[model samples]
Target: MQANIGTIDRALRVVAGILLIALSLFGVIGLWGWIGVVPLATGLFSFCPAYRLLGLSTCKRCQ
Candidate 1:
């Protein structure tokens, strides 16, 4: 799939994902922290199925 996520969006996702996973590892959060993987994967792939389904794109070119 084409990259629908922009640089800033991807960076934020990566950061948020890392923080969530770190909190989980440190026992600061419950298993829900594992949910961070979703953002991490989408960030790396630069494609969000939800965004597609909603007809949204963050990439400048895509717009």
Candidate 2:
């Protein structure tokens, strides 16, 4: 799929995802934090299914 996530967005997602996962692993948050995997995967892949569904894209290059 084409990359619909921008550099900044991707970076933020990765950071947030990592933070959530870390918190979960450290028992600082509930297992729900494991959901961070979604953002992590999307960020790494630079593709967001929701964005695609909504016909939105944060990457200017894609426009």
Worst 10 residues of 2 by lDDT: 24-33
After superposition on all C-alphas, the RMSD of every candidate to the true structure, in Å, is 0.8, 0.5
lDDT of 1 at 37: 94
Scored by TM-score, the top model is 2
Give TM-scores for every candidate, taking all chains together and pairing residue i with residue i.
0.93, 0.97
For residues 1-63, what per-residue lDDT tens digits would candidate 1 score against the true structure? Answer: 988998899999998999999999999998899999999999999999999999989989777
lDDT winner: 2
- Model 2 lDDT, full chain set: 0.96
lDDT of 2 by residue, 17-39 (tens): 99999999999998989999999
Worst 10 residues of 1 by lDDT: 54-63
Give the whole-model CA lDDT for all candidates, comma-separated.
0.91, 0.96
